[model samples]
Target: MDPEGARIQDDPDVKVMMAGSTLRKVKSRSWKKQRHFRLLEDGLTIWYKSRWAGRGHSTFSVTEVEAVREGHQSEVLLSIAEEFPADLCFTLVFHGRQGNLDLVADSPEEAQAWIRGVRKLIHKAQTMDEKERLDQWVWDWFQKADKNKDGKMNFKEVKKLLKMMNVDMNEEHALHLFTMADKSESDSLEIEQFVYFYKMLTQRDEVWKVFQDYSGDGEKLMLEELENFLRIEQHEGEQSGQHAKELIDRYEPSETAVKQGAMSLDGFQMYLCSQEGSIFNPEHQNLYQDMSQPLSHYFISSSHNTYLLEDQLRGQSSLEAYIQALKRGCRCVEVDCWDGSDGEPVVYHGHTLTSKILFKDVVSTVKEYAFKTSDFPVILSLENHCGVEQQTVMAQHLSQILGDTLLTTLLDGQVPQQLPSPQELKGKILLKAKKIGGLEQCLDETLTDEVSDDEEMADGDPESPCTEDPPAANKKHKKSKLSRELSDLVVYCKSVHFHGFEHARSHAKCYEMSSFSESKAKKLAKEAGTDFVQYNTRQMSRIYPSGLRTDSSNYNPQDMWNVGCQIVALNFQTAGLEMDLNDGLFRQNGCCGFVLKPEFMRDATSQFSPEKPEGHQGYKPLRLSIQVISGQQLPKVNQKEGSIVDPLVRVEIYGVPQDQAKEETSHINNNGFNPVWNETLNFVIHAPGLALVRFLVEDYDKASRNDFIGQFTLPFTCIQAGYRHIHLLSKDGTIIPPSSLFVNISISELTSGS
Candidate 1:
């Protein structure tokens, strides 16, 4: 059944949206103006305009919308709350780093209509199957290509549409296909004809060759043939026959093919595109990892400068950044608190031009969103620069807003030998800050201690750590005064300065944690890698970007995780390869922000060193073979009208120093629509347990650096060994669906020395 047809009648809000209304698009307090808004008949897009007669209008797809916020939930809407009723406002939040759309309706009924309607459409988009998604994508292209709005396209328009879709086809061949689809004896074609033309153009010859190799007949695969394919190609062992029957039943679109227990070309393609055919193992998609282990046994997803949306020196500090981080399953968030002019502490980068947000509001936002994505504990790493009085106010806000979720005392009412598991601290927030006394002394009211803020400002010094003696002119020193009110909240995760590995191994408590700058952490991982791994067994460690990174760029978190560091913090506001790796590593195990470290890394006396991996126990190497087959619907890197991407695939492995390697396929010229490269890349990984495989696609260039098109990353343990589809993601980590690489992967164990 079509979901749209099934739900349209029961949805009155959707009906109201289709009827259209006049709304005030609010950018700022003074920039509110009337605009006409209407949902198109297709129900997949919305368009708004200040005047209906001109081309001065904008349109957005319902798929772009992530969620709808009612009332004055956004900063822009809050700025005009006094002028408008709360019920008359709403905001449309988009995926990735796109800005939110704030608007005001003439009536509360209109506001509710748009809000509920967009929410319903978003749900529909999310629930769409692969086949439905493809059809919708084709219709969207049709809409874009029909520039004259005549619902029909000439050959000229069709040619332009092909370029827009990242296709550089031969003109003579395109005209022939165009004539084949135009059965009306006319030079133009409609939407149905356009879809047919697309199907003919994108028929995968590579898939057809593979299909022919297995099928006795060229047209379909019989049950016995499919079982053979699964056994020989997919290495499914004894269950190959059962799995083949299931695939045919689920993916075969034709009723005759389903009854015959055979797979046609279409069904085979569908099976290859399904989750069962993806490179990532389906078993790892949910909460499959053990979560009952101590908190230090897993890698925690963390963000630094969580309140800033941009750079540290000058950026906007808003509650939205915290909300965004929490929504992405960030388990730890850092807040740098300074004294506000109004007595309440403010959160922002100190001595910078960045805007300030009240510390109370930041706590409130965290309280609301912390458990929305994952129920695991959230670590609030406070960089407290506030004085004693304002520190008390900050503590009050946390206790009041977070309330029961704020863990004010020990879990068992006694000091613990090891930190509690995520299961034991579900829905709880732990403070990671300096404390005045031990965990058992939190009940004392008058206890206070002074601690040097050296670790806090360690990276602020501009000199290199290798310098023997830096000049005194570059030195910056300070001490933070810990207040009892705030210290009481620090039950676990007490921030402390590192006094060297021998000292920590002898004296450090399990609940204590230390922060390290990226440069310092990198140095430790390189020089004392084994010691770092063993130290993280009992206590957690956080690795943060250096303060000299004023632009808020991030270092690779893989190196820190190589040493078993739990809290590897990065600037969540920045988007790059570092953030991509972070997103990919945490995308598994229910995306709960805690990935259990390898068993060797979790043992107390483990001798694992990323620099020298052969010394570790339970070390086994494996050979990885990947066949780069083809790409479908890859987006063009350049937006020029006639440009199409000359795409290539680069397979990269990130693990220990010995396992890091990359290999690329030759570039396919002027063909991003359906490029084929029947080439295989081989890799021998020394530390397979800790390795992450990244599949990157780039538009090859001779005169400059290769432009990144899309990529996907997954842990080596989670890779499915078979013919699979690797769906691609854009630079900002948004899914560019129907855009994927079809590949085959095989893994085998390596013998003694070879």
Candidate 2:
């Protein structure tokens, strides 16, 4: 061992080592005596070990050696040379605590031999059938590189093929490949070039030598020869059918068979027990866990059947039964309420409550159950299917009983009076007012009577039984009197505190009142001191107020809410409102929540549930809205002398900027009236931002184009910002209508400076 090499190895992490005769004295005498043997070699240094001597074994062993440079005095080959006289005197081994154990090389011959061994190992690692599928897949890819059914590949072909494979190659770089292995540009590639190209395509350098060895005369391979070579290589293992079967057997699907088909609940449970990973997929598992955990409140539509609570309630019609159902995990209960002649709130679907359970009982039971379980709170939603006056009384009764815990009161056309006893319940009572008129009447009516006497009886009439004033002819108008009384009652109600209102109406009612006067309703509401005027989304544009009087036709929630209306209940049946739910616009822009029919809520929840609940039943409520924007009759373009041209006309609808254009398009197509050639076309419509619209003929041929003569703008008047759909028609019928286009129009508020 070289003394200098030993010192350098001892402090491997150290930077430098100085060599001198003092270092040489530290070496064993055996190393010094082997000077002649060391001189034959170069850069020799030695080190000696004194401890840990075995019986009759030399205590000192060769630790490290340095070979002196042939020409330079300072330059030397530094290495740890362990003696293994039986094999090689100089052995390279990885350093270990038990002296070097992992021998890298026994001699110079062994070092060269290791390189050869590594090459073979790499080749075996990349062998067919043993290597990763990607390695073989790359090779197969090159065999199919020639596209366009071409028999041979040129530079352009190669570039195009590489591009098809998503290879990044610029034109200049691609052109440079022509001479990559050709050695000369003859406009044709030789076998070497083709082989080199194949190698480059496959990204396998190990196979290059095999291809070069097989290339005869280093010229281009014929198409037939190339195909034959590929086929031969692909079937090399298959040549022996036994070996092919063995390969197939090794990669066959697992021995355990997997059953397929729809799984029963029991089967699903068993499968879950058997699976090591999550029973549901990881994504669904997380969602299930999130849903299974205790929620602040669990909202369920009356029709939901996931749990047995509803069934249990259905089994027994008593409030105690309902309470028991809740103990079984019913967090919220929905009761449809109708006015009872007894002037008390009742739970029933319509005018009669002969069979259905009473609303008062339901509320009382729910309250008791909630009080019993401090952790499990019970919330009640009264779906009012009664007159507006009945809804008011029910709201009063609910405010007295449930207080702030009443989740929602779905009234058709009523706004509840604010209860002072339960201050927290102020916002909890949601009055689903169906239309502007109902809310307006509720807010402004003062129950005042106006009487006019048509004629006065003579003093002598009726045996002079009358006092100083004589009675006049009596003519009773029931509806007028009722309306007047309702108006007066509204005034009386407004004198007290009223929380807020919601609009819950069928799609048909919303469409029918689409043309209702929002401004007048808003004025009436303001006079009555109501918080907000809520309406179905079908009336968004009509009910929303305007910033400017000129564009007052466009009713906007922003304008209404800005004018002291704290909340604006949005009907969710319209597609525009549904999109708002997804975009978070409802939460971001308004303080109001949504009012959906029990059935609508159920449908939406069921559609989005992670797992389909068992025993699901469908529920229906006529709250879906369908409105038409415009339609036009096609004139006779081909007829000479009043010959009607049956040109197909397409109608296009545009929605307010903030409204979703796609939904508006669907609404127009579904609701637009089918037009006849000579008759006038009419449609009741609801859309957002219905701005400029036009109709046109598909083919502009001279004979057929005559029918499309005119285009029509919507509303026939300026509309306010927000969603507005109006009745529009093209009278002339000459302009060919467009197949329906829904445009989302967004108008930003003007900045102070801009």
Q: Give the candidate number with the greatest TM-score.
A: 1
Candidate 2 residue-wise lDDT, 1-754, digit = tens: 2233234334321211112111111122133221101110111122222233343222211222111111111101112223322222222221111122122233445433323332332333234231232223333334456444333467766665554333434567456665675556665554446656544443322223323333443332222333333234322233334432332234322222112112222222122122111111222211121122111111211111111112222322334344433433333344555556686655532322224555666666666555332232333322334555665565565557766554432233344221111122222322222222333343454534322221111101111111112124223332111123222222101111111233323222221222112454465444432222223222221221221222112233322322222123221111121112211221111111211211211221222110111112431111112122222222233323223222333444332222212222221111111221222222222222122233333213454333342333422112222112212222311112222211112233333453
lDDT (CA) per prediction: 0.88, 0.29
Worst 10 residues of 1 by lDDT: 459-468
How many clashing residue pairs appear in each of the predictions shown? Answer: 0, 56
In candidate 1, which residue pairs get closer than 3 Å at backbone N, Cα or C atoms, i.e. clash? Answer: none
TM-score of 2: 0.21
Worst 10 residues of 2 by lDDT: 68-77
Badly placed stretches (over 4 Å) of model 1 are 1-12, 52-54, 440-479, 752-754
After TM-score superposition, the amount by which residue 176's alpha carbon in candidate 1 deviates from its true location, in angstroms, is 2.9
Off by over 4 Å in 2: 1-300, 304-316, 320-358, 368-393, 407-754
